[model samples]
Target: AQSVTQPDIHITVSEGASLELRCNYSYGATPYLFWYVQSPGQGLQLLLKYFSGDTLVQGIKGFEAEFKRSQSSFNLRKPSVHWSDAAEYFCAVGVGRSQGNLIFGKGTKLSVKP
Candidate 1:
């Protein structure tokens, strides 16, 4: 079965510290991948996506991810994390060609310290 796994359920990072959130996927073929952020009481917001293109994809809010086919990983990284970045981050994969067919990871909650 295809799935997305976010190893960390919760992470705490000091303000201005570098951050990296891991995401791994299992699928038969190269699948469409995405990273989404959801704030408290807010809906999910797209941070970035990877389909068929360069290995490195840039995203909104100074975020970026690299698609590693060999490793089956698409990890999200940021040079510095802000308190505003504290939220829940989800890693997802399109199960089918259709955009609606997606399987999302449990999600990782990020907490920023002062």
Candidate 2:
């Protein structure tokens, strides 16, 4: 079965420091890549996504992700980290054509240090 993996269960970064959250997917064909952030008691907010055209996709909140077919990775990156960025980040792959056919990773918890 196709799945997504976030190697780091949790990560800590100092304020104003750079951040990179890794995401890898295992699928026979090219899959839709997505990154979402969920704050405490809040719904998931889309950070970025990669469909077809661009290898590097920009998202809201200064987040970006690069899709590397060779590595089967769609890692999310931010030049600087903010205290409010503390949340659970999820990397997902669309298993099917439908948007609902998403398989999410266990998620990586981000902690912003002061």
The TM-scores, one per candidate, come to 0.97, 0.97
Candidate whose lDDT is highest = 1
The Cα local distance difference test for each model comes to 0.96, 0.95
Per-residue lDDT over 1-114 for candidate 2, one digit per residue giving the tens place of the 0 to 100 score: 899999999999999999999999999987998999999999999898888998999999999999999999999999999999999999999987864688999999999999
Candidate 2 Cα lDDT to native:
0.95
The pairs that clash in candidate 2 are none
**Model 1: C-alpha RMSD to truth?**
0.9
